[model samples]
Target: MSDSSTLPPARLRPEAELARDALSAPVLARAARLARWADAGTRVDAGGGLVEEQLPAAAEQLGLSGDDAAAHASEAWRIAVDTGLVEITDEETGTVAAGEDLALLTGGSPQDVLGVWLTALEAVLADASVPDLDDLVDAMAEGGEVDLSSLDWDPEAESDFLDGVLGNLYLLTVGEEGPGEAPVPLPALAASVIVPSDMGEPSNEVLEQVSDAMMRLDDQFRLLEPVGLVEYQPVDEALMADADEEPAAPVDEADVTRYGMVRLTPLGLYGLRARLLDAGFEAPAVGDLSDKGADALLDGTAPFPPAAAHAETELWLAGRSPLDAARELLAAARGTDPGAPLRRLRCQQALSLVGAEAEPALREVLDDAELGGLARVWLTEHGARDVPPPPQEMVFWLTIDTVAAQLAAEGNSEELRALVEGLARQHSGFFDTVWRVEHPATPEVLEAMGRLHPDKKVAKEARKAAFKARSQQGG
Candidate 1:
């Protein structure tokens, strides 16, 4: 459902605090460590599942009972699998191994490790059961809550509502309300998220609905607790029952509002914070004109969105020498990927700022194949006398530039592949001709095209071409 309210402001945090919390949170990282330890000491069963005895170690590691041991191990394994920390090639028979990303995650900076974990969490709703969970959470995020009556309340919608409440639980944890910072009470969360104005006070049906909502809320938290994203306390006795047992007894002992609190762990807070940033929440942009030179400023602003970069560049280019600006710009442009047309255009804008003064630097690179095309274009536009026609290499680079610009602007991957194929078909020696062009990005472009190509055969040829190009550059 759509709503007009804006998302809550994301609190700006220091790099030190983010890294410290991520390192201290320790649950997912602990799970990763255990996965590695298990691979060495414990044997995998024939079915590729961990041996039963290993469950005790995993459970004890986390301070759970033997009854909770196996489930705990299974949940950790699922987390490991989902986050690419563990790879089981064949679920039924193949041996488990630590995944490629495992080392990068474990050994990398805490900031990066938390980022990887959050990325996995972001995709947690990909299962068929909760496909629209992210969308529901997004709706609720507006003003930090949506009206309960406004939502569809059928069986599927009830399920979504449950997930949405759990998402809100994370939001509430990070939000400061009186600063005690414990898990938010279930009823309090419900009251904030759900507005039931139409339902009269204290009807039997209303009470039952509220009771069920609490139970569902508790059950969802229990399920998530094993994944290390939350700490849910005052366990509702109803959830301790086996799946085969009679359905959980309705709330009887105390008020439904009295218990069942959930809160985000430190890592969970950071994860949600990252999501807020991804959803267009602004954070402080540092490394501006104060310390960085034109070269550093150009490099720093190069990767930003066009409008933001343009604004930043306009400020940065002020009070700088035009000739020096041109030199820095051309130097920066030389380092950009051939396949990144947008970067080249930004380079063009920076180049244009230099006017006639940049001609001296442009002359130096005019005969250089990789940079020559840009130089030629810039010089011709400035009314330089009788510049040579762009060579085969420049034409090839420009073609790649055009396709990249189209892809970045329109994002049609299918059309990108088709465009690449058409160019390849037009010249059987396309790869060979481009390989010797001496442009800094020639090899990079060929390799990137290989990855982007839909057809395996073409991709393989593109890769081979890239390898050849690199070797030519080396020779």
Candidate 2:
């Protein structure tokens, strides 16, 4: 045998190395076969036993004794579960049952089984601190074939070998660390790893085709579990004659053959994406509400520029009706000119027609700096009516500001007076700021401010402003 230790380092690309490592291991070869079988929709059934009878036969075929076969099978099963290739369930009787749809062993074609094993093996090898290709090949080739009938059944040895293999596989594929210490799995890894170069977006049609293919593969493999029944026969002829009675009702073949299917989960979606990416399609970025005019349209209080208004209206119509023509018009307007005021006005009018549903999207844009003072004021006036009460942190200031502004804007002098008095009784500083800086300081405004100014300094300032406004107005 060649001295693996003395061999020169093999110069190969990462993909080539992965391909080589995958082909070197029997366990991985078997796994790859299983994956292909699963992809093809093959069904694999396990007989009712910890070690199925057919499993031994398959082991014998692979040149392993019963113990070795059992060991390898157990290891494979454990690895598969750890890698999420198979799901396990607990029976009421405390037995752990493997799902029927798991395409491991059970007469799946060697190629299919090998493909799954390789896929798993490749994943493990990606992170494994393997010494070299020679080391990996040597480790895989260490065990020799055995005959089951000649070997003694040592459950512990089998279990130990399985544990060792799994440990090595884990270390190789992930790292030499416990679960929490390892890096979190990325959802996009599969896309980067498995998909080939030709497949495109995972359209519903493509998914359906893949699902159909898997279903057909399952039917072809016949890897489904079988139901066993006990037959009680009389030992003696006389007893048999005496016990003779109607045969038990015929077993329903359909009931015995039925098995549940495994549907795609989120992880499976990641895996599917990976497979598609491997197969060669670029995943598209899903567009969000911000991408549409919904963000600008939702704030009902804001005075939109004609372009923004048109965009909002188009978005609303898109949500409301089949306004394809209107949408086209909006899109055209946006692309038409840099400073088209009339276009923007037209857009706003269209959005105004859309109404309330646009509120949330509009509110989201209130913090946008680009919208300018006009938009902010429009949003304040139009959006405030529908704006949910300000959150707790802002409530105190918001209420004071709202009340003060309304008092200044109110047409009725008596109501204005009452509002000003209320402000003076409450937060006088806030009232002072509103009266002095925020209001227009007309005689009515000054009188309202004067009534609320509680501090001597604030009261004197209010009085001076009130007198000047009165003198100017000739009141």
Provide the RMSD of all predictions against the true structure, rounded to 1 decimal: 19.7, 27.0
The worst-scoring run of ten residues by lDDT in candidate 2 lies at 223-232
lDDT of 2 by residue, 387-448 (tens): 44333223333333333334523334575556555655666454334332322224445555
Candidates' C-alpha lDDT: 0.60, 0.36
lDDT of 2 at 2: 19
lDDT of 1 at 405: 54
Candidate 2 TM-score versus the reference? 0.20
Can you tell me which runs of candidate 1 are displaced by over 4 Å?
1-5, 12-16, 19-27, 40-48, 51-65, 89-92, 119-159, 167-183, 191-202, 225-228, 235-257, 273-475
Model 1, residue 459: C-alpha shift (Å):
74
Please give each candidate's TM-score. Answer: 0.43, 0.20
